[model samples]
Target: MPISDVSSLLPLLVAIPLTGAIFSVLINSKHGQVLTGLLAALSLALVICAILLGLPSEGLQSTTAFRYPLAGWEAPLGIALSLDGFSALLLTLTTFLVTVLTFYSAYYFSASPARVRFWPLWWLLVAGINALFLSADVFNVYVTLEIIGLAAVALVALSGNKAGLTAALRYLLVGLLGSLCYLMAVALLYHLYGTLDFAQLAAKAESNPLSWAALALITVGLVLKTALVPLHFWLPHAHGSAPAPVSAILSALVVKASFYLLVRFWMEILAPAVTNDALMLLGILGGLAILWGGIQALRATRLKLMVAYSTVAQIGYLFLLFPLLMSAEGTSASQLAAQHQSALAAVCYFIVAHACAKAAMFIAAGNIIHSLGHDDIAKLQGMAKYMPLSLFTFAIAGGSLIGLPPSAGFIAKWLLLNVAIDTGQWWWVVIILTGGLLAALAIFRVLDLAFIKPEQASEQVAPDNWQKVPVAMPLSGLALALCTMALGFNADLIIDLITIGGGE
Candidate 1:
């Protein structure tokens, strides 16, 4: 395919999964699983092709943004889908993770009847994620956000137990509340600007009360959806109670869909209206989320809950980008631009790292539950002896979460620290380091119990009673965990891609 034609393929990223979802509803259970898996794999391939074709030829100065107008109509009249460096990277990440999890889900749900409802909901969630990343208008973003939240809620309810149903209900309420706030912001922005296009809004937005109101509404809505700190009460319960694959999708991509929008709103569309005090306040909230989430993770009694709380903490790191981009009064324009690019790159790296590591950890936790029929932290004693692969997967992913050397998490934090220091924001450095230590403590708490001697284990399961975990489960998780480590070594490609379109 020619580079220029890549833009035309953008809609396929959304179409394939949506078609699969509709087809899944019509098919029988066995065929639906097979069809879902094949369509997901195809979506991953399409994303890769689009990304390759979309990249600027070698020796080019920057990336070209690909825009596809629906039915050949331009923005402000018809929907426009765009693929820039930021959106392209996220599209690839979303598809890659979805493909791997689809494989895991196939095996994970082989014996369960929930497989029927799972395939369609899973595909709908994938469609929502792809659409949200590609959407170039605020109204479309809100539409996609609603799709993602609804699909995710239905998926969480698939467990069909009281806890799962209750968690799903709470997730539904939280999602509805967040969407209401976001829709209000969208309406306010439209009323103020008379357009929904991102670029148009950015160009027209001013430092006025209405713009500030829109920004505030956007922040509250996205913050609640992203589950950052005080508004994060809904996440742990929803993510921990859902099935493992559902939990992986929620923590890995669903929350990220909202955060991605928040980044776009604060850093791009509403940049003119962003205030220094607001930036610093977001940073402070991020810092608090880091500390509070880590402490809660340490106290979590269940394996899945611990990983879910860790997600809350990792999200905090991304918010620090807001304040880090608040240039000092005397900084040169060139220097400020450089700092902005660096901060964007760092947060992007953190998002990718957390998605991979957290997904792997959740899958590993699912494997443990499958093998031993429970996920109680105390009862996980000596798990390493029998379930070495899953335990190893968990530990390696935990290492990344702790920002250990040679892990993608470390590279992301290193970039963030460099930006903080370069921008003379030294206080964030202290918070970053403290958060790492707290993460290490929480991770080690799990590792310590898992690696205990079998004979000395207080609640070791009998050998004969251990259920056999399918090979695909642990292998799939290990693959994602290794991707996190691999990213640590080869960040230049991602950084270069991220810098395309000038890191906007």
Candidate 2:
């Protein structure tokens, strides 16, 4: 489905929330917060409705766009909001997760004195992220990315603690620098191609030295922002210190946004031959991060920090797709073998799977934090009695992360394994399994500690029920995680849409 209708409302889907943010901030009161939350929910609900109504009959691919002129002009000079299968998938995730996160935050921050402040900034961030997903031009993407980054920092600092404040500042500096590098790369692309539109640039980019430099800078900038290995120094600290809802959004979507940009810029705009080395570089670092992060997570004493480091490990799996996509045998080639790049499917599948599962894990962790008043893994003995939802949710999500059977993660891993074998490159398989095993070690460490019954009476402060975060919230994420696995059984559905018009 190509975008034939400029009145499809994709731009409005993003704009409504941005406007709602200003409306909410202007009326900052208890009534205002409640009203804003309701408005935010309604706007997102409507966007999802629009998506549902427009979901392609074809199943796997869908797209919609609004070629709105900024004051009345043509597309080459103006801008447009285009939603392809990939962008639509991202949009659905953003809206679904925002709705859940908003609901969870209602209770997660209920006891806090500053609920009003959270809603405005949080909604604004969601708007920026949605806008990022919708933008078709490089400059628009950069602008939306800037807004998302600033609002994210504000959300992080809302905790008002030393750790949160410090992490926010550090994340800001690194984030801005990365943004700078990406902006420069985009500028170079514009100068070279005379176009900022992704589609236009894709056709124009050549495997020349100047284009190659732009590709390298863009790839490096996005990888840094995505927090792949060595460049991920700020993520664990920021994620560990933020409130649970914030952590969920950060891990599930925010960091992934950078990765999405990498996909858009590298796999779409730039010629494949221009950046194979960088992709391999990313994959190598991703493999290392998988093992290193999992082991560090296993050693962490605090639950939130443990979860944060777990993020570090899970992120590594995403990068594994790079090398597979970039080469025939970890070496660059002008032409790629179609049979060798099954890793693209694996990457898309894993991202969808991880988004749902990680969101659940973070919300569940919040439930534990709220109910138990602490996140120390050592202190959580017999927590199943009080935090069953949290424990079980973590387990289910962890199962997915570990590539266990009947889970989406497993489906994704199997595909990547097939790709490696098909290409006669089995070392990547070794890295994948090692990562999965280490993830298992980290997961069981927490579970074993949590399952241990204690002698002393660690009084449970929360009442038995309503004790965990809202049932609907975590359940939504869990349901999505299940859908991710269901994708395997329904492979025909996604395959049909993966290459729909403009899904390149």
Candidate 3:
């Protein structure tokens, strides 16, 4: 692969879609919607090509920074677009999932009235995600993050119900609060470090109150955004009440934006100064999120809401990588750094697995709701008989969620577990396995609905437009699930990417 652009292609990934956001506004109403989807698809395709055009190893290859010096300035003064292995993985997922999400929304809302407003907001969201993944500058990251919040709000509002409106409002309030905290943290960093770019801050930062405060503020704000445990009150209602595809994005990627920010901050901005105590705190929270999310998901009345709760649980798993990454018990610094890359890579892998699996589950639940006129798990019977594709998709995604063998989920869990044990963090191992077990419980609850005979005879199934759902959507989920399982065979390539990734 060759370099993508001589001067700058990195910013183009973000600018092109953002430009589409403006251009999409000029489109005639219905035409605008079509154009928006096309633009999103095109932008994503270009990003994939550009990403592929980077330095490669295998499995999780990434094209590093496509440096475009803003106004032809140098590194410290100009903004750049850096696409490391992790970012590339996420960028690809973001685009691909957004495309699927748009298509899914088309049929999901086809008979519904909200169909008219869904596409534009959905496209802007794709744009936001692209920008968020590609952004390198702290201030620029904030701009993109705000766009995500706004677009999500609009998407939520498209549901056009009282519950939707109320949920959107709650999301808005928390979103702004998180943004403010992040902004204040950014301000603190700029005040202390005098540079908003990650590389510069990294070089300048030392152990100090300002740095700790800024990092704490940023981490807490992001935790709020990711809706981790105590700060996650806004998520269930917002994701549960939104349209199906919207819920998929909310569960799959929206919350992940915050997680991405934290990872960037950790890996690029503050690797050394962050203490073991902080990592421990994150692990503890991760454990709670896992347990609480699983229990709540199992208890949810609505299937969509149950998936939302599962997301909460999935987030807990993400944080367990921290302590494992921070260890130097046996390994030297260089090896630990290399291991850090792999751990971070595992996070990315987990993200992709979760996104595909969760998307399928949401779509499956939507199918059930569409056919049955409700999503209550208790009411579902003979779903597998009626909707095999959807059920199979659900099962595949569930397999990934539970860390079952041969799936990408298992590979990710296996790698992280090894890191934990090597570092003498047995607690993390216990927590992860417990989380997996709880995930098993939640997944089986839904599957149980389909297998068990109805207590009393149930009414005949209603006519369903499930045929309208694209074969591509569920198949895409299945492919991801299967790929995850297959990932176990390709650990070497994944580890290679991670080895080079931290440097990229």
Candidate with top lDDT is 1
User: For residues 72-147, could you state the per-residue lDDT of candidate 1 as single tens digits?
Assistant: 9987998998877787778888888988998888889889989888988999999899999999999999999999
Q: Tens digit of lDDT per residue, candidate 2, span 1-504?
A: 243342366767777787778877788676667667767777877866665556555443223333444445545698877766666667777777777777677766666866767877887888888888878788888898899899888888888999999999999998898889889988888888888887678777788877888877877777777888888899988998888889889998998898888877667778543556777787799898888898888888888888889888888888887777755545544336354335666776777778878887777777777666678777676677666666777888888888898887888888888887776668889988998888888888777766656332255232542245566655655655566567657655444434434331
lDDT of each: 0.88, 0.75, 0.76
Give candidate 1's TM-score: 0.97
TM-score of 2: 0.90
lDDT of 1 at 439: 91
Pick out the ten consecutive residues of candidate 3 with the lowest summed lDDT.
58-67
Clashing pairs in 3: 54-63, 406-485, 407-484, 407-485, 408-484, 408-485
Work out the TM-score per prediction: 0.97, 0.90, 0.91
TM-score ranking, high to low = 1, 3, 2
Residue 47's lDDT within candidate 1 is: 63
Model 3, span 14-77: residue lDDT tens: 6666666666566646656666666667776776766555645543222334445566765567
Global CA lDDT of candidate 1, please? Answer: 0.88
Cand. 3 TM to true fold? 0.91
Colliding pairs, model 2: 60-497, 61-497
CA lDDT for candidate 2: 0.75
